[model samples]
Target: MPTVKPRLSKQHQRWVMPTLVALVSGILMGLTVAPVEAWFLAWIALAPLWVLVLFPTQRLKLLIPLVWGIGYHGVALAWITGVHPMMWMGVPWLASIAIALFCWIAITLWGAVLVTTWAVCMTVFSRGVGTFTRVLIGVALWCGLESLWSLGPLYWSSLSYTQSPHNLVILHLGQISGSLAVTGAIVAVNGLLAEAWIRYQGSGIGNRGLGKSYKAAMRLFASSCLLFVALHLVGFGLYSRPLVQPPQAALKVGIIQGNIPNTIKLYPEGLRRAIAGYTEGYITLADRGVDAVLTPEGALPFMWSEALRTPLYSAVQQKGVTAWIGAFGEQGQSYTNSMFTLTGDGEFSRYDKVKLVPIGEYIPFEQILGGLIHRLSPLEAKQVPGSPDQVFDTPFGRAIAAICYSSAFPEQLRYQANQGGQFILSAANNAHYNPSMPAQHHAQDTMRAIESDRWAVRATNTGYSGIVDPHGKTLWISGLNTYELHAETIYRRTTQTLYVRWGDWLTPLLLGLAVVFKLTSIQASQK
Candidate 1:
């Protein structure tokens, strides 16, 4: 006898299509960044979600966008799974899988909340508004949310990155309003498209309803087109012109990638090997006449005391060139993820890492999770955070060093730049993450270069070590999992852009304007 498939209930059928739309929207969002680098997809990526939100249907509107969030964040941040196998060493396979799933779900849900909230706001606050006003409100909501979150640690993939490594013209908009300006412009265009689609579908040519909708939609679309064109034209102008005079001189920076395995580098013998590997790389670069030599985070593999006794210290002092090496520095009972800078005079200036990775650097609620954390990992003492506004007086210029995860917060580097920082130095240990994370991370630094109008020196262990100019151009880039030494001429600038001076004040201002427009629309409808 043939078996019959179970039939879905009417309720299930109602939800299935919207769920698929959400998931598709999420996947489109992920494709906007690296590993695929289809940046243009971001322009229309939100249209599907807009279709779901703008049309009145029996399906839950908020729920659909939540699903979209899960799809988007899940794909974009899949690199978090790389830490799971390492967890397997201490926990059972099932437990490791559970841990990974928990993290993945938690982060995905957090990002999903942004999408869900935006949909709800549009559904409620967009009443009695034309397409232009509605689209402007949408832009405000997105920019406001982005500005609020960018001040903290969870500011990855702000949608502005969708233009990077491809759309340099649009990317230049970052110099004026920072990344949020670019984000607002993209969302406005998306909003106009969504409005036009809904209007065209519900009405016909030459009909009164169709004529009104067409005029409203076209007006909004024309306004959006004009704003986008103006922004790009200004961006092109800014890209061609240097906002600040070039630095009095340049730093012939040498960035070294030892390509040491994370597992091996953590062991005692691995520590010795890491030092040997880095020392050899340094000798090669120094011989080539670099003004300064840079190493990735944890290049020393030993505590500051032990590293001082080693040949790395003597070599830097003897070579008579400035050096920045990543290592651990202890003070009393705590140690920091530190960047140690040695001048030719043998004097050292230390800049400790302030923004620690959530679970990897320090477990939150340590009083409770400390035992479980210790059992599952090799960390002994929680890493100490360094003081903010700590600038290093390097021979190159007044440089600010952002270690590993600190680059996630734009404010951290911005503060340093405001305090006379000329160039930004980012040193990272990206060995534990997948390829996608490194590409995204590098894109963030490029935003920093544009926002602050400063050249960037990125030194990473295992890959993506390169130099970025003030115009957000990649001067020199490296491949992943390779042992290579690359050098580039980097300049330091003291000029600050509008974004660097005013920060993200535009977001709240836009939000206020949106609120006013909505209220005006409401009052006009009442009249």
Candidate 2:
């Protein structure tokens, strides 16, 4: 005999298809997000998972979905690994790697849990339901889970963002119901494909039923294709509507990108560079007759008190134009990551950053893990969070201020928009990670701009400073790791998009309908 090969056991054989489907689906979904931007893949990325749900043979359904979650989040959030080699934080080489890996793994697992929960709900609650009912349940479950996760400690990489800044038509759907509406459309299309796949497979079974089943499957496939086009049509209609501009002077805002390395951002040399770079950019923009200027988050990298004594502060005072500069603000005994505005009239106002990063900003479960790791954040002290209901009142207009991580939360920004925020000022420091993080962060800002129907001005450290119009169009964008200054005229509109007024209303409605559908299906089965 040439060779003796062992065949896979029945149990292993059963798991083979599910495992492959789960991984393929997850990875494709991940690639649909930013940096890769294979948005077209998202339409069919979830179809395999839905098919697996409709015809599950694996003993552990949750295991497959959990693996799917891991695959998706691992790829989408791979930028989190860029935090490694944090020797600049005084962490030992191996310890720094360990911390970065820990953060990446922990968050990936958490995100995976959401996917697993949705899969389990669909498998359990959608049994014996018709194809249409099952799809309704699937869409509801997915949107509901997205909404729930958004309210939690970490929220990024929503399904809605898959279309952002690329598929302007689908992205426009966000104006109606935030990201949930876009997500619902995506899930609905995937579910229809899965239903068609199931019917096609059934067509191969009995000879007598073959033609009818095949025709039905073909009809469903065509219907799905039509529905996809119809959704795009609706989105285009929404996108075509012109935004009502307020009858006021356009505010010309300048953004300064100080390309400072995160490793040395706190060092004496780094601080000197920060001051010089921003001061130079600020003065240049001021000379250009810009109404206001915005600096990236932590552009000063020092306390507000210390910043006031710096040359940058002196430059802003002399320029006599409002400057929104990012620095640390004092709060009782702790400090706050804040955006401080130096008004033209020499008055000062500050908007402290809420939604601090869990371990990176402040160690969570400090009573347990405090002593285990020396420090993950480069900051010398733990920072206090600001109130969520804050807005920046500037000479130009009242603007929503989202400092770095806060940009990921849509409802938070929507509430600020409802509170009379005319535009969005997004300040970020992306020096810690690679260009992917900045790109993703910029995408989030774009979504916020569309949902609130407000122009968004983004200033970032070490790259991707730009301006976006109300319709998710980038007016101007800077290159990564560049020291640049850009000024663009953006309007301040008082009209709020429907999303701003409703604020995630679709999520609750979907969840409630899912419950009713599930109960009705169960009752019908019993009868």
Candidate 3:
């Protein structure tokens, strides 16, 4: 019989094992997004990792969180490594993996300091305080940390808000508080469970204060659960009720998914293919009696201005449906990412893309980057910024469009919606990464619809082309990689939502409350 591999000594397993586990898990997570795994939601699954760190000797306790953090970061940001090669050269996938693992390990070590502080404070405070106060304070701290993360370079895409396979009801809260609010709840639960495990483990009803801790925790959790239900139920109820009636009646829209490979998208033949694909898609929609058909960003390979005026517009005019495709136009001084709209009657209107992709679209500080910028990226000319965020006029209605990552920022979309964007149109090319990314990244836009109380029309290249309603529900979807024309009827709203005016009000308020709470705690401790 073959001998079994000997178990590693405790000293070796202490650091290497945890880091390896984290690294492997992170890579595994990067492979796909299907069968959405709530990577860090459950108390049962995560508690042991904390215990491994907590129950260890004082010297090792420091390292415990370190290892845990490596795993957390690795798995969380694993997918980002897939696109690293596209952005930077001489940077191997291993380098990205190593960098991601180390960065996460370092961040977790820092985050562990805050979490340890909370654990200590909880132990101290829980001696006399009720679980209600502890949960509230813990929730606040978690929100504060998440807010700090939002300001940093590495955004936590896997925070509690992004927890996949979670109850749809929990996701509904995003409309009221944005993604951060759900994160706050998740972090608080994690802390609460951790404290409870330390204090009242294995104790039934026999323990004296155990009953009190249980009651306080129950009340606090119940209150939070109720809040989530209220927000979700109210928002979902609106969706189930009669559909919204926009200022204008329903506008027939045709969404074209031209599955262009990354390499060819920038090539001459690729541009030719893109133009042909869009023109053909628009023609199909026009034949179907639709009013307008949409195409993804950078739709036309070359200058479509002359084409829109001549043969393109003339062909589209008779089809009875307008064509809204992303293309470029020259305004004498600079180039713009403009949307070319040819009405059925051949009336044309142009709208430039407002929010540019930071590095890909326009290098922020051109003077600073200098000639090295050209060397850094192979693109001939980094796209210049568009002058103004404009509205596209059509016989159907006024619609505003965001090019790509711009939609991820809800405030921008809300502004456009408020600026007479009866419907929000977002165009993106997700062909840059593996297919799953565009699907998930596009999912984030559903909140834009809910928060703004307007219908969102999301059209993307290579995947996740669909329509979302004001309540953040998917009405229709055309999954990635198919030669087909997809369409959806989404009702837009005339009246705007509360989130449109204020824009992420809960996050700032929560952050302010955290500051105040921390200040008060410091003062009380000093006293």
Give the whole-model CA lDDT for all candidates, comma-separated: 0.79, 0.86, 0.58
Scored by lDDT, model 3 comes in at 0.58
Model 3 regions lying over 4 Å from their true place: 1-73, 84-138, 141-167, 201-242, 246-248, 303-314, 317-320, 329-334, 344-351, 354-359, 362-379, 386-394, 519-527
Best by lDDT: 2
Q: How does candidate 1 fare on TM-score?
A: 0.92
RMSD of 3: 6.1
Which pairs, if any, clash in model 1?
none
Per-residue lDDT over 67-180 for candidate 1, one digit per residue giving the tens place of the 0 to 100 score? 888887888777877666664245666766766676677777878888888888888888679777888888898787777766554557677887886687788777677788
* Model 3 Cα lDDT, one tens digit per residue, 464-509: 7778776566778777766558776665566665656655566567
For each of the candidates, give the backbone clash count.
0, 0, 2
Pairs in steric clash, model 3: 22-71, 26-75
Which residue segments of model 2 deviate by more than 4 Å? 1-12, 205-210, 244-247
Error of 3 at 210 (Å): 6.3
- Which scores better on TM-score, 1 or 3? 1
Which residue pairs in candidate 2 have backbone atoms (N, alpha carbon, C) closer than 3 angstroms, thus clashing? none
- Please tell me which model should have the higher lDDT, number 1 or number 3: 1
